[model samples]
Target: MKRTDIDANVLIAAFQGEGEVCQRALRVLDDPDRKFVVSDYLRLEVLPKPTFHKKREEIEFMQAVFERAEHLDTSPTLTGRAYYGLEI
Candidate 1:
């Protein structure tokens, strides 16, 4: 599907360099075949906070990536509750 499901932390660390995990993810993302899969849920997870004060440009770039990537339906229900209208 030319898609990869990446964790929110990886995305955050790639730009902010908060941990080694982020460094590794950036290396993995260098492969031309990889594309991060996105959804409203992922957006909800990552886009809420500013990682730093002056990185709006970086944030906007990341937002553009999420905006253009393939989207997926989130888990329909978690435990017994529906999340994003999809069953977990």
Candidate 2:
């Protein structure tokens, strides 16, 4: 079985349910052969519980993923954004 780390954008896209993106996310997530994994850092980023009042459905979906998916190592902190060979 192949395992892959799921990014925040994929989860966000699925939650938002934007046309092609949502379809793609669902397809990958529904597949049984591929195993999807997330880190503690990513769990925090995409599944924040404090501000889901307006997106109850999204929160529920995200929670399901968080509960079902395999968790890896802790997420790394973003040191800085680099551009033009400089940290910005």
Candidate 3:
């Protein structure tokens, strides 16, 4: 299967250890034939957890995901529009 873009909500659900969602995420991750694509913005949004103790494991797991997944760079035009309302 081609690489897929995993959304933030799915990551959140997996991190929170929701049984079904975690299982689903695991299935995807376990598929050797599949390529996973993740955006750098998504990584930045999900990596930081305010509650340190609860988030440590999640952060570790996400770091592992990052190691395995392809990260899509946010273009300057996109970043500028998102953060500074500047149209490129």
> What TM-score does structure 1 among the candidates reach?
0.62
lDDT of 2 by residue, 1-88 (tens): 7797888888887778678989998888778887888766675676544244456677678778877788876524441221123211
TM-score (all chains, Cα) for each model? 0.62, 0.71, 0.67
Better of 1 and 2 by lDDT: 2
Kindly report which residue stretches of model 3 are placed more than 4 angstroms away from their true locations once superposed: 50-54, 76-88
lDDT of 1 by residue, 18-60 (tens): 5677678688666678877877677656654553344576668
The residue ranges of model 2 lying beyond 4 angstroms of the native Cα positions read: 49-54, 75-88
Model 2 C-alpha lDDT versus the unseen true structure: 0.69
Cα displacement (angstroms), candidate 1, residue 19, comes to: 7.3
Clashing pairs in 3: none
Evaluate all candidate structures by whole-model CA lDDT and list the values in order.
0.65, 0.69, 0.69
| Total colliding residue pairs, candidate 1 | 7
Candidate 2's TM-score reads: 0.71
Question: Between prediction 1 and prediction 3, which has the larger TM-score?
Answer: 3
